[model samples]
Target: MAYRQGVTELLRILASAVTALLVAAPSLAPAQSSQPVLEISGASFRPLPIAIAPPIAVGDEAAAADEIYEALTFDLQVSGLFEVVPRKAFLADPREPVGPEGIAWTRWSDVGAESLVKFEVTKGAQGPKASFKLYGIASQRLDLGSTLEGRRADARRIGHRFADELVKHFTKEPGAFSTRVAFVKRAKNSKEIWVADFDGRNAAPVTDRGGISLLPAWSPNGAELAFTFFKKSMEYPNGHPQLWKANLGNGRSSAFVGRGDLNSGASYSPDGSKVAFTLSTDGNPEIYVVNADGSGLKRITHSEGINASPSWSPDGKRIAFVSDRHGTPQIFVMDADGGNVERLTRQGNYNQTPAWSPRGDLIAFTARDERIVFDIFVVDVATKEVKRITQDQGQNEHPAWAPNGRMLMFSSDRGGKKSLWVSSADGNVQRKLGLADDGEYTDPAWGPFTK
Candidate 1:
């Protein structure tokens, strides 16, 4: 039941920790909308210039409005889709009316603001009610608007919700702003699972078991996480790394695959019905799949060399994994039933930790180059073209795709101490996620959008 062979070395290869924050859900209400949607093409992409006026607050909601403004501004800055004009550049009043008719379009246009945003927050019986409006400067028309009622403690969520709507209005798809990223927070003698907001806000631990935990994976529903846990406790004096599932709602964890000699690299299917992971039950590490509750165990890879890090395709019809059978660790893919296996990455001799994108077009992975430095890369699933994401970044690894597939989060020591970093998939925009300076974090798993 415990991994007595190669477990210690494996632990060193996949070490990580965690932090998280939680808030109550808020109700949504659709406001006014009229739009000549913005069309953005990658070949000729330019960040949209937008001005966000200071949020107006009524009654005792100043603090809530400020929180919402901070969160919303951060979300847009990192989105890679907009250039948020600075407040210092503002020619218009910060306390502008939310209605389109009362707006001074000429002043905003003078500052080169293609679009403008205005919001107001009022104290509500339930909490804080935030109303948002987006204006197209050229058209001088209201493009999109929404009102979200959230708890005062969750004013940040209200901001995130409006940001998501802003993204959807232009891209026709929801933004990943409302999602969370789960990472392993490493301390002196402990490694725990932590979930932070997509922007790395309000990070706190979700796991407290005294053990080595790594490679956290989010369930499709964003309600649970499956990670590898190794602990030497009363039941098992010998520490073993096995897959464990943690419920985000109640902070409860249970063994999902405790029978194997080693269980790691848990990946949930798109439907959340089953999980694909690495198991070493037969002495050789290989990919395996089982029901979410740890039933119906089935081996997915039968290889002499190590096979691990199974990532499920968005359609739940295929899996991307790592294998060393071809003489070097490389990315590989196979059908959901473990048939039709094919190699994915042919460029790197030491490529591993493949994470299938939600769009199913690219698989982000970690590769060691001739310089012996590890960095993140993504391979086009259809064309087999490999694109390096992190260059000369300090030991970047464990690439986890954002829910929208437009961006990804990876662990890097570039800022020192192995913190989480997010990057636009094209490697054009990158930012270090704001995490604590004292702790080491790794193995980021970006969660799906919350329901």
Candidate 2:
């Protein structure tokens, strides 16, 4: 009931804040019905036949926009939602500053194309600007059009944004291919938290206090991070580990729970009203829920053994956690109010870091095999079906799901050093995150994008 009460209070606060802000600046309020709705059924209906022609050159600029067009086309194709017809395959190119002419719609229809994208490149004050237009094949009407201004080096990001907008026009859900990941970077002497765009660009260290920071978890809004840091001194070599929250936007941070002893593994509630963390201040490591402002602390579990890794369900109705209360670590689920506790895993000898999927269907955790090799596995909450997700190589652990629940990000030693790797929810298409100078990066946590 504490979690529920905390969430209720948070919702009330947010509602009041929004109301006050709206009242103070009515003009700043967003339009009630500005968002367009694209039915998910559209995905099953039919993928639009899209044709992307090379950008028309402007002035003396070279052919730099070709790479941007290719990247954008590839991004749309990977989403499993678009049918891109090659320009070479087409009888004629649908270049910009011109309309669909004698070109056979029959050819596109034969190729299963339902849409077309035509673009042109122009020289801008800053750099090259790309102008694109999307047209529905059947209606021969424009669906969306926009111009992106950026330097040649930033063409990739601009292309991703363009594709993302295109996906939103047809799918209703925001595309996450352009999002970034935040995680903790650890070394022998100290640990720091870092963040990078999804493609592993613009990675920078967030903490540089020289303490042993670990277990970085993102707030639902992606504006703040919760992590644990150990303060070392001559008298206490091991140091005292405490939980801290950092506001990424303004570089402001504060200690979340300063009771000291050992407070770590903090995860924010789905609504960002409360945080569930493990505290050993009471002798044994146990799970506790507290308000976002660090008030009204309530213990959730009182098992004899260690209980940690609390993850909230998407609807904020239940929490999935890991517990060794049954001797070895196993996945457990309980109501948000800390009632109706039940065990969810039975096959694995050891299971830890249970992450509840955002889709609210499966729970991912690290399971050790008979050979004591740890790998990632998912368990269906309803059917209790256990499926192993990781297959080869060294230990793979700390599986974190993307906001859309389409893929997972986890830490692995498969690349000779501990680095972040992403795979489909079923553990396919595994690829390294390609971070800069990978020096033992672990415990990756994906954050929701604000836009």
Candidate 3:
């Protein structure tokens, strides 16, 4: 009966298009319709054929142009929607196009490209200026267009914005380009929290607490981060980790919820008004909810065993967490006020670290099988259907959702070293963050879109 009620509610929301609908403000047309994209029901979604010409440089800025080109190509390809045509197949010299009027649509169409995108980067005294145009090959009608400005060192930033706009034109949802992913990186014997560009290009430490700093959770605005800091102190000689918050603006941090006892994971509500965390002052770890200002503390879970990893639903109506109350750690969902408790993972004997998607369609978590190997799994909230997102990949855990809900960032030891990896929700394509960097990463939390 509960499953039926949930399914009916989901269908009603789906019929009205109540959720997963993004405004078309970034779309260059300014009036793009609210049509849907390929559903994520494991449908054989078609990738649009799009040829992107190498970005042209104004006044001999080849490196800048190339960097911009790379960023754009990566963004579109990783999106899992657009099929980027090879630049080697571009029949028209990108530089030959003085403007959109000079595009050789026939040549692009000959190469099987359904659409084409062109961009020009100009380095000026004010910094760098970028202009782009998207056009349909056969129709010859401009699908979208936009201009952006940024510093020469901000090539990746500008490119991400451009890619997001392009995605908006096609999917109506903004791409994950403008977002940042906060992760924990290890150096020597110390673990520090670091924040980087979504694609893991510009990475820098957010904390230098020396001994260890883990469990980084970003504020909804991405301007602040809450983490657990551990260090040697007179009272805690062995080391103790207490919850702390850091301001990304000035890199300044202050104690957040230092209960002077064992405290664990923290997550912000969708509206950033409340925080759900696991505390164990009563000798039994239980999930608790508190105001963002650290007030109105209340307990959400009364499980006798360990209860941790509270992931709040995007609507802030539910919380998905891990509990071993039934003798085995499993994924469970409960209301924000801790009512109508329901078990979500039935088959798996061990499932933990559940991260609810931003779109609220699925909850991704790590599950251990009979072999004692860990992998990622996603469960549909309405249908109670379970799908494996990772398998046999060397110990995949901690699946965090990008702000757009189109991609997931998780930690894995597939390459002999622990690092953060990104993939679509269905686990179709997986890649290492930063491509070549050899940094040990964990506890990745994707921040909100650009401020």
Candidate 4:
């Protein structure tokens, strides 16, 4: 689609406050600790200042331990919750103070650190074991402790699990680090579905079909994905797009809806028992739903122009979709049973791709403002109050919400290259994820929380 374009500018932004290590001033004493100031109130959030000590090399595999060290550091940093103390300023050795009780709490206070995480990762015969010790600077006490065990190849997953724990301890909400993102990556001459870690690591192709793929949607169970795929040939010289589903675990891809003259935007229902998609078998695109098995087909919208991108509400009571029934693309909400239709987004004439947050509190979508720039915006489903997320930051589209509703990942051309960026759900603490390759990524879909 022409709507998909390369980003014209580069801009990196995050609203969460995180600062590096700072030595305590002369006025401070070893017994004194920093006050707890990190809290989330409404749309505003304050990043906490925290320090981490390197894990001691456990065996002859000290070099191997480096992977865990780097992965852990990257997870916490991208979390946008803490200002990590630089390694050069790390006053404490990873070997000493193995236990919190044997440590000098004043050292962190002296370095102006408010919170701390001291961990030891060891590769053993069984697997890798990471011992994490959490602390509060205000009291110089151990707040929590846990052990994570994973296979050697699971080093990154281990780090993500540990980072999420820290975020949970401080924010009272689960972190999004453990999740993954699925998107369309441009390869050679075609685009295909690809999935990567929350930090954009381990990116690999999910489909080998040499064609154009877009708008991936993960099933609520995270076991399958549905997306729009187009393969041009004599049968489809002009490109006939169809909706297809893939078994993410087994690498199976098959069309679920192609009878329509044009099929795209396949969104699974909250219950995972049915799917809502846009089908244009009648020469006019309209919203439709069918059983998970592709049976019990039912049309949800009747319009002359277009109605696509059907996003279901969390409760399964309603669906927020895009339609041009009013002359311009705008967001609309209708009952799950197809009744009581009402327009939800009133401000923008060019609004589309409405993604309802898992928490059911907000709906994020893309809109082209009067300035003729595409940006991301979120509307409170209850109050209908709209909030702008990305303004003048290259074309930002495809806002996908993390399962916890704490973060959102979208595709942007912030640096003149179309790549995925993750940000706090409220547009705070944004960071561009560096995927494995330089390939442009688009239409990211944040998957559900993994077990």
Candidate 5:
């Protein structure tokens, strides 16, 4: 049965190519703007200036321990929340405290160091253990101290956790540098789903069977995934593509919706009781709400034109979606019950794939250059101001916000092929995720941390 379903989806894709072209007409033009707006906010307090002394080596010599220290130092510097002072300027080693006075606070202040990070690497039975201490120059006291144990192979992860703790003690927000990303990859005739750590390590495929699997949406708890798959050859066999759910813990999966013409673009609500999805079961693609268990299906939009890609607001009272009821695809907001539809994007000729941020203050979506390319953009819900997050790249689309709403993940073809990329919510730090050979990753939905 699954084999037949896969073949049917492929026929639908070929048949829908003409309709897609018609709906995507206006997107073929180049978007023009005199200047682009970039969002930047100032921190409430000045960042602390700190120094990290070279780690003190203990026992036998080991190159892996030294490499771990170097990577940790680099992580702290790139976070942009700290100013690291040079270790060469330290007058005394932390291994020898100058008298009980705890080193000279005046000397550190003179050298422009407001804090100090001293670490000692010791060989343990299991592996290496790094002991660290943080000292504050202003208070003239030790602020924090701890020891972390890990195998030499996991040295980088240990370092990242240590740096995260330091940031939390000072900034009051957990650092996002240790998170992970999940995305879909497609190359030529092979399609697979994968998950990787934030730094693009330990990438492994979750699915081995190659069929037309697309549009992966992570559950709020990050334990399950909802996506669309094409497995049959019949033309619109059961109405639309089928939706399936996969449980990451046990590798169990099952069909969620199969009676529709197209059951794609599914997202879980913040509270996790319901799912917002795009369905064409009613003849025209429209936004629909259904229980997470696939019961109590309810249509939310009654517009005459195409309406799809529904994303629930953080409060769960409203939903953001893409609609062509205005003659072109644009972002629209509607009540969860399908009342009070309002247009959100007036300037962009083609805007689609609306995703509400978990923070509840903004909505991110893909805005195409009415000429030839697509880029990610965000809209402030209260102010109604729009900010383009990606510049001229091959094609950037399918944006999903992080759990904290401080970062976003999307797919782009900038490096000559489609790959997943992540950026700060403000568009400051943008970087690619996944191996170069992974090939054409798309539809990245950032999931919440499970542990």
Candidate 6:
């Protein structure tokens, strides 16, 4: 009953908005009688053209409005669902009102925008409040709209929230813009673990103790991170990598598995109760599983060749890892207890960093082609069909799937520097994430959607 009531109210709002537009701008073309179904995923998908008008700042909200606008624009462009129209081609005045009566629908149409977005920022009781509206130009309908209030310092988050809502309107699944991404940013003497927004904004170091922390993996609930820390002062005191856990709340960390000669590639189980990692306590590297608290340690793989990069399946019944037992490092899947081992990738001779999709349908990984250039690829779990996601984009590696499995984040040298980049699941849309820091970013771990 509540769902129906919300839909009824949305229809009423759209009716009022469209009626005002038609009456105020009668010379415009009549609204289309029908709308096309949008396909945001799959191979047949085409990006929808949308126009995001300049934000209308009210009172002293000009700065906050600009920040929100920039964030919203970036999210839309990188979403792979919409092709944002450049503001330089806009024919309408920039100061136009967001109300339906004042919108120049014909101008937006001339600019080849099927949908239009209008944002308004006002001073809220505590900080800044924003109002967002999405209009279907052809149908003259209000497709989506929301009003949100947040701290002025978090204006960017307000924009992210609106973008998530917009994506949900079209795909029924919310966007991953509000999520965080953990990555390794290499410094002169240390490779520190850092966390930032999905788009690489508001980055802050998670570990500042001046050592190397690699392969940052988020717990399913996002309350903690599992990584490999290398330091000479640990129990081993040998500077060997050891699995560690960090509480994101208090920024405290402790070794999770320190007895092994080397422990790395920590992948949290779906339920966040366990972690599967690679340990070299034996003569060679092998996949191992341990409880989240470092108890019940068990080796999962026993192979002559190295076995590493253990990624748990969504159902927790299987684990995907990399193995060179067949003479080439390739993706392999085995039961959680290391039974029924089966090779998953058959093409590339050098394939590693297999990231299981949250949907459990695909596993994204990095491979070196015949030309020795690294690229991202995904293999279907059922069909074993491999699809290349990046090509000729410089070296790209360490693919990590978003929580919804609709997108992936990896590191790329495409811009002449190694940085974080994100792409759609089908590789149709790709964009480089913007980070202010000047250093190589790698091993990107896209966190789960925030509460």
Index of the highest-lDDT prediction: 6
For each candidate, the alpha-carbon lDDT, in order, equals: 0.86, 0.77, 0.82, 0.80, 0.74, 0.88
Q: Considering summed lDDT, which 10 consecutive residues are worst modelled in model 5?
A: 30-39
Better candidate number, 4 or 6, judged by lDDT: 6
Question: What ranking of all candidate models by lDDT puts the best one first?
Answer: 6, 1, 3, 4, 2, 5
Output the worst ten-in-a-row residue range by lDDT, candidate 4.
12-21
lDDT of 1 by residue, 1-451 (tens): 2575578766665553111111111112222354545566557778889989889999999999999998888888777888889889999877667766567788999998998888999977789999888877776666677889888878898898999999898888889988889999998888899989888887989999878888898888899999999957676676888888899999999987977578888999999999998888778998889999899999988879999999999999999999999899999999999999999788868998899999889999999999999999999999999988889878999999989998888999887678988887777778888788878999999989777
lDDT of 4: 0.80
Candidate 5 per-residue lDDT over residues 1-451, each given as its tens digit = 9989989998899879978865533222222221121122465534457877667777852464576566566556545456677667776655654222446667677878877776777887677888777776665555677788788776666676787777666665666656666778787786767777655566767666567777877887778888887656567543347788888888877788876678888878888899988888668998888999999999889888899888989889999999999798999998889999888888778898898998798999998787768999999888889998899767999898876676788888899888888776766557776466747788777777556
By TM-score rank, best first, the candidates go 6, 3, 1, 4, 5, 2
lDDT of 6 by residue, 1-451 (tens): 9999999999999999999976555333223333354776576878889999999999999999999999998888877788899999999889988866677788899999998889899998879999887778876666666899899889998998998887877777868989999999998888999999998988999998687889999999999998999868656565878888889999998887987588889999999888999989767999888899999999889889999999999999999999999899999999999999999998989999999999999999999999999999999999999999999889999999988888889999998879999897778789888897578899999999768
Question: What TM-score, to 2 decimals, does candidate 3 have?
Answer: 0.88
Candidate 5 residues lying further than 4 Å off, grouped into runs, are 1-118, 123-127, 135-141, 233-240, 434-436
Q: Please provide TM-scores, in order, for all candidate models, with all chains considered together.
A: 0.87, 0.77, 0.88, 0.86, 0.78, 0.90
Clashing pairs in 1: 17-184, 17-185, 18-184, 18-185, 18-193, 18-194, 19-194, 19-195, 19-204, 20-204
Q: Write the per-residue lDDT of candidate 3 for residues 310-357, one digit (tens) a residue.
A: 999999999999999889998899999999989888877989999999
Q: Write the per-residue lDDT of candidate 2 for residues 360-441, one digit (tens) a residue.
A: 9999999999998989999999998999888777999999888877678889998788888877666645667668774788
Rate residue 200 of model 2 by lDDT: 60
| Pairwise lDDT winner, candidates 2 and 3 | 3
RMSD of each: 18.3, 15.1, 12.7, 14.9, 22.1, 7.0
Shift in Å, residue 78, candidate 5: 6.5
Tell me the deviation in Å of residue 427 in model 3: 2.0
